[model samples]
Target: MLLAALIGAAGAVGAAPAAEPNTQVPAGSRHYAASGFPDRIVASPAQDAGSGFAVAWRTAPLAQPPLLELAVAGDSPDMGQVQQLRASSQALQTENGDSQHHRVLIDGLQADTLYAYRVQGQGSWSAWQHFRTAAAAGEPLTVLYFGDTQNKNLSHVSRVIRQGWQSAPDARLTLFAGDLVSGGDGEDDNEWGEWFAAGGWLLPGMAVAPAAGNHEYFEEFEDTPQERRVLGKHWPVTFALPSNGAAATASTTYWFDYQGLRVVVLDGTSALDLGTAKAQASWLEKVLEDSAQAWNIVVVHQPLYPLRAERDSSVLASEIRPVLQRHKVDLVLQGHDHTYGRRADDGASLPQYISSVAGPKQYRLSPQARATMKPTAEDTQLFQVLRLDDKGLRYEARTATGRLYDAFQISRDAQGGKRFSEVTEGRIPQRDCPRPVSPKGRDDRCWE
Candidate 1:
């Protein structure tokens, strides 16, 4: 069923059959409010970013058909010169009832140009928002990367995002390793609302590329809930991602080039399952071999090498590590352990693998983590800023309050190899917050 949904055959394969009509509905605010206006607006890079970009927004029923008006950013307000595009709208049933999801692709845009766009609701129009396109490859660029912001989306994670934005005001794009929300089934309309609330107005003008996490899959079947776990239904309809990936995992496992960097997003959860692992692996090798970009980065939810004490991702390490090493992938950004861990590749050109958490949830470090990874942190939420150019790459990880915890740089040689070095000279000491005590007033095994 999961594979079927990934390939857009959910209907034929049978979507998780509706069990019982949900009686308990959650409450949301602002964006989720049925105010007959467009909300939850977001921008994403198009497959051919040199001439295109995409936007998605939500509206209530009976609202005007979604319309987008766009023009090159200019001083004069020339309404006649602007172009309007109609978005494809789909009705999705949510905890807040039915709402329409609309997406529009603004193509034929010139590269490296600033453009202003606005969307229309039934009778209301959103204020204009602005976004810039990617400059050509080889040019210097800065991007922000985040880990699992699943829990406390509006309260805790929002601070990390706002802090990152304030720190890297010149960032061209944002990337999430996975788990953007705590709700996997997608029925938690309030959670998605909180996610948008957390981003506030920042996401509307930025191109965001996110990978899927295990939490993004909701078990929809009532008959055999344990066996059936497909992607949250809202995922396919919410974001307008590029459809150039593995046959079974297109939107969820695609690759795109931003300036000089090539980012490949993989469906790690699917790869753990035998049925889709081979296809994902084959597609990964092909994408890497065909790419000539200066920098190659891979983003996924699960780490190739697990960082927590109770977990071991032997399957991913054995199946995917060799290909990554062979291709000399520059960086691997991952999430899922609710901790911070960075491992410099041992005697390998692919020198950086970082697993970080960006939400409130924190886990105790595994005993083996001390031997495998350096500059590790527990009870810490982090966001990393990466700057890439012809010289090399610089990365810095900071806490929500804007305190540096880890930093590093990778120098690229003339022959395309990389030399890694730590740059954490004066960062905050590693956080090892004690586990919460139970009602019995005893130590939690997490500390053990």
Candidate 2:
């Protein structure tokens, strides 16, 4: 395996036990500067929805007044300079932090056309970011998925993300499973630079969809003026997205269709386990029932079918998974478990889970769950790359270097159920992580 591959899913990673008795690291010290990033950007990182596209980004300390300009991208990436059409923004204070958010909607865009845009805020206007509107009829496309880039974020985190881009340069979107930052006391801030680096120019190079993971929260970490003044600021101001996906609200929860694929996003924090479960569940049922696309995918911060019994089945299983199975959702993507993991079909989930920092790391198994639930001494760093083509869909679990670890392909049957043919990059058997070690025992405090 390539070193990159070994660094990713194929390489071994140690358990990320919180408060690991590290005298060297300060409490939440790693992320104190997360909000310092020059910008926070969100685009309809999912496939294009018809006639529309979403864009969002954060402005710290509140833009005197947030603003953005929308326009079409130049064909040559330098040609058609985007013409500013309109702009809008808002301020949100969450339990975590405070931030200013700006979003703009553009219309009259032709189908399958690439539209580039830029944002304007206090003392600055952003470089053009581009996205395409959904095709009238869906088309096959490619997207990238990253599990957890939260730990030891910095330039290293960007390395994992950049490889995905290098592997699929023309991908339609990048799917972020959450924990973009370490939420505990905002130590995740230090790594924001790496997050941006991972996307590099690709952030605006292509769209990115980031779910809110458990670590994204700000749990009354401090009564300090700074923490109390801003919540969800960094996220909203950073990226832009479609306004109509989920009840058309600004929260990260919503759904959009790219060609035949229907991508649905839920606030696992809100719908799965948090108080929003009842409401999000109802919304999910409606969204899944209403979807007209052939392929349906769901995304959330937590795993619906967690691999380890140590952790509870993510809130979504009780609150959401049934809806997916009922709707026959094609793919479900997540990140909180940290370890790179996936399921071939809507069956029982694999026992393997990967959680690691972004930097190079060796893999280590957690305490065993059962005689049958131990991770092999030989572990690999893992990640996933997915391709959707005219014939069928291909999902590969790969490590950091770019070697395929686990593979599964699904073609549609006349009955509409997926016919799955599975493959592995190398000739290797499966490895299972320890049963869910003890729960992180995180309360719903920050979520509230």
Candidate 3:
């Protein structure tokens, strides 16, 4: 269902069922708002940043709109400086008895400076939240990347996100490849809470840029005759984002600059389902051409390089990779495949491919692809900590317990030649093993 148009600083939008308008009367089914509290905060400002940010939250039908406040820092031991920071407030409600809300864009923030804020509803505003603005051009910075954090999220999501931060305490930004939540389940209430609970305030701590995954694509199911997009009410209004650059009515697909890095965010669902493929492709190409940042990273939900047979149908592989190669995109971070993979296509003409999974699950790599990737260890829950340098880049894929699974380095020469090198000197155990024996079902001799 298309989330209803958000209104005012605190507005609630309704989710119109895909293919069918929700016929159920919005005024009746009064559960009486007696069960629990609806507290959520998601940040994604629409296009035209205008040096502004958008905020969204959820609440009970009968509850009063709380005092939503903004601040400069979060949970400071030095609360004495709260007055020194600037702030704002607002309120709202959705058509389906759901209380939706928004906050004023805490205006006039210093570029690349720290700001703290908070929310109030049930009783008082929650803890003070914090985030920073993008740095000026030509500055080098580090950003965290993750793919497929959907399954068994509550039990395992925190370990991976916090662990990544633990590894790089000062990472400038956080980017998610896709499938933030399992689509089939939690299509209704509790998922958003778990997402925020798992990561807690840490997600809002840094500038978060999440690519749209299949889970994020909720609206009328135009493809199927009897289907409609469901429960997508939480996406647009829950989060606050920079209103600078984006395409279309929604800012779910937008781009931002962080420390000389032009991080482009695109929605795979839009490219595949909507006829906006050409429009997005042209915009992406233009962004790449116009961007002079030292590093240009593109983050999306789908993978160009597939690890499983099911993942082979990548629309972007045909539609997007050509543009990336043409524009000299530095990195492409994506999810959907639940495995650990880092393959630099020595064969591809330009740029490099580094795909990974940071989840509680694990996947086995094929020994057949060893000609280039050389599959060594089998780890389901692994995160890559990549450090970009002028010379090239260094990547370390580690297990949740902090075990190093794969390590590789790429050094670029002045002539623009890239050198791929593997890590043989980590504290972790060595995986320099041979390929496993073939199964009885196939012939190993005449293979790919």
Question: Which sections of candidate 1 miss by over 4 Å?
Answer: 1-31, 62-64, 77-80, 184-187, 222-226, 436-448
lDDT of 2 at 355: 27
Ten-residue region with minimum lDDT total, candidate 2: 439-448
Best by lDDT: 1
Q: What does candidate 2 score in Cα RMSD to the true structure? A: 7.8
**Model 1 per-residue lDDT at 339:** 85
Candidate 2, 131-214: lDDT as tens digits: 766555436678777766665444345667766677777776677777776544433333454466456666665556767766
CA lDDT for candidate 2: 0.57
Q: How far out, in Å, is residue 54 in model 2?
A: 2.7
Cα RMSDs, all models? 10.6, 7.8, 12.0
Q: Tell how far residue 247 is off in model 3, in angstroms.
A: 4.2
lDDT of 1 by residue, 192-292 (tens): 77788888877889888999988777655647735765787667777888888899887588888788788889998778742566788789899999888
Assess each prediction's global lDDT (C-alpha) against the native.
Answer: 0.80, 0.57, 0.57
